[model samples]
Target: MLNNMLVKKAFRIIRRNYGCPGLDGVSIKDIKQNYNYYINKIIDLYNSYTFGRYPVKTTTITDYNNKPRDIFIYCLYDRWIQQILKLQIEEIIENDLKEYVFGYRRKLNIGMLRKYTKSFNSKYILNIDILGFYNHINRDHLNKVLIKNTSISKEFLTRIDLSFSHLSNGLPQGNVLSPILSNYYLAGIDSMFNSKYARFSDDMFFAINDLEEQNDIINKLVPELGKLSLSINFEKVRLFETNSFK
Candidate 1:
């Protein structure tokens, strides 16, 4: 059943888009063996540039010999982020381990878009517009604040309770860190898999060289997120081996 879902062009497009200098020699079977080294190097590069002040884009360039440097630095930062993603794909190819899968529950689902984009043969395809969605929710939160502030204190208390009741189901208030933490985990999966090959919304795929490593990731993630009320549906979890193993 899953075999029919495979879009052969997805791999071709990924190779075309992210196939870079260091990616030249990697293969699908050796990804895991090389992932840690690549990720460490990426972390080193990010830490080096991201220290002191966050990279920003504006008409400010008093640093680096007084030449306009902020925009160039910002672009460079983005380039490194992209290169790190490419290396992750190479890592996936080099490793031969059991495949891991995850099922996600979220307010929105983009399963159809995932299907459609895969069918379209695009180089970089992501169904959900995560950035746009975040902006929309933040605007809504701002509106709620305006409504609360414009009202009388007694009525404001009642409206605040009602507003928060609705907001919790959307994105929890006073939790800007929640979004960062969620993105961190999501990004970590991409780093782990070294591929946009990981599915969104309903599923995630992890291919590791060792079965034990796969279990280790699950153990780490489950406890890390346990206090946050994040959950997993174990019934949907399945184990499969490539036909090459048999």
Candidate 2:
């Protein structure tokens, strides 16, 4: 059951933040003006186990490189739902996630990656990029992974499936919950390798001593990724030796 206090907190946070209205044209002001009505509506939807789909609007923003990057905006109500789901999912999977996952979390970045690598005395690094990672995530595969990682009720699973079914091909970027979902989806890959590895979103770094170990990891990973409709970007694969260790 969704906690009322958490729901209220989620609503309060979204109401204060400035964002463009979603497909339904429900602005933050509108939601605030009719806060009670909106709250009732959200509760009713939750009770009925039906979440209405929201249309995505695309807009471009300049990235750190000063290049335009496209971002998807979903309905405010949908965003609120995402917030709730994110909290729930995080609580469920937080303890189970591998330390190698550093994306979307604070104080876990390149420095931590460096420390992990040095501790393992890794001489060679294999950096891998998954081609079209979010677009290629198979829904069925994700469902199985979710079920395996946590205990969820059938009703909750149905609602989750309905939410994802609206996405069709794969998870969308710019959603609060997407990063966590992507991390969990790739957890299987992390579990398969004993070699030192770390991931930040779709980019993965594997530390090994020789080409043989690299090949061994790749050969095993490719087929596993294939099952989830994900593939490696052969063109982006780079192997480099650590000068100090080399």
Candidate 3:
């Protein structure tokens, strides 16, 4: 599925969006210097169906809380490859997900989220964030969800599976493929909460009948999320009156 034409387009998209070189500090211009070479390398990696152990630059940044957070960076070619994979799978996964899942989906935004949540017409709205979402997703569960929900080729699946060899958990935050995989895994939450639910990435919103039902959902979410090795960020959790949202 990693072909020359698609890879070339992926390269152009990367160049247009790029701000800096990655991992090895290799710029998109540097990649264009021997574009075919990088393309060949990515295509061969696909044929081999093995994780290339591609390099990612690691750096720390201060988050809103003034705490340090480490983010991963991938080289231009790796980003190209990831973009191709994302192009292949995101639509399929997005279609499988509910309309309320607003994150990383095309043609979706806070406006759409608001419209959908309002449709529930319930008495309250609960907003809760998952703790360390991108960094805490279990790799094994991610693999399972991706395979179950996507129809990618065996070779493509192997390339993803092989990637798990480098790390035991978490989707690296920077790559395009990370969103596709992460969104699909969180589909469990979408399924578990059938209606009156909206999720924009890790932030989940639920429309509730009252306090009793809200507590019951929260109580249930703890263990269900625990099954995925994830937990709620209680400090950030908020319950709002329906009109407050309106």
Winner on TM-score (2 vs 3)? 3
lDDT of 1 by residue, 24-114 (tens): 2444334346644544543553434331122332343452113222212122223334333333332332232212212122232344324
Name the TM-score of candidate 1: 0.26
The 10-residue segment with the lowest total lDDT in model 1: 1-10
Worst 10-residue lDDT window, candidate 3 = 159-168
Give stretches of model 2 more than 4 Å off. 12-20, 60-70, 243-246
Question: After aligning candidate 1 to the native by TM-score, how far in Å is the CA of 54 from where it should be?
Answer: 41
Scored against the true structure, residue 145 in model 1 reaches a CA lDDT of 35
- Sorted on TM-score, best first, the list reads 3, 2, 1
Task: For candidate 3, give the lDDT of residue 18.
Answer: 79
- Clashes by residue pair, model 3: none
**What is candidate 3's lDDT per residue for 6-116, written digit by digit as tens?**
777777777787755676566777677887788887788656664436676778778533546676677665676677777767677767888778877778887788778
Q: What stretches of model 1 exceed 4 Å from their correct place?
A: 1-167, 170-197, 243-246
Candidate 3 regions with alpha-carbon error over 4 angstroms? 49-51, 60-69, 162-166
Query: Candidate order by lDDT, highest to lowest?
Result: 3, 2, 1
Winner of 1 and 2 under lDDT: 2
What TM-score goes with each of the models? 0.26, 0.84, 0.85
lDDT of 2 by residue, 23-85 (tens): 878887787798889887777777676674767777878743243455667787777876777
Candidate 3 lDDT score at position 213: 85
